[model samples]
Target: MGTIYRGGSRGALAGLRRPHLHPVPSVADRLNAERHELAGAACTAADPEVFFDGTQDATDVAKRICGGCPVRARCLWLALEHGEAFGIFGGLTADERRRLRRKGVSAA
Candidate 1:
């Protein structure tokens, strides 16, 4: 007589299920993601007053810092997404970003 298996047999189900594999992100990818974050930004080290300043001199200073930012596009996109009402982002003031949104132009 053949051996009977139970409905809850662990051995039968174990072999039928395949192991799930997830690809690990490379160091470069991790670095890139980190680089785009606010913490890694040039503006992070800058005085907060400069970003929110309405004066031309302060705005220019903030823009100069943003001018060479590697993650400028990402910064702009985030600012737009969050509807940031103050500060300079991606070399553009809050008003500028708002205008771009009104024009249907994204940070890209």
Candidate 2:
């Protein structure tokens, strides 16, 4: 068994155990970390056609790659928040994000 302490907070650590008090990263912070990792990769060998060929298939491939990512949701949230109009985020293609925004608007 471990002990948990509420950092920098008085009395917040009371009645808590260490193993149960884990820190969780915020979505924006996590996405920022992932962006750094994904941005430096070489996109040259990647099929430009797959992304730029003006086809849904290209977006599909992009989404597939995002799906495998661990920080997909965070990535998507950050992109949406920042009004990112391109690239794959949160396992969703640009088109998907557009649709999501549209849906949100319609719902409201």
**Candidate topping TM-score:** 1
Cα lDDT, all candidates:
0.57, 0.47
Could you give candidate 2's per-residue lDDT for residues 19-108 as a string of tens digits?
124332222232233355554333323443343233678777855666566655555666566555544556666677789998882211
Clashing pairs in 2: 3-18, 4-17, 4-18, 72-90
C-alpha lDDT (0 to 100) for residue 94 of candidate 1: 75
Candidates' TM-scores? 0.60, 0.46
TM-score of 2: 0.46
Model 2 regions more than 4 Å off: 1-34, 37-54, 105-108
Candidate 1 C-alpha lDDT tens digits along 1-108: 332222222321121112111112222222233333555577656665566557999999989988988778777776665555555767898789889999998634
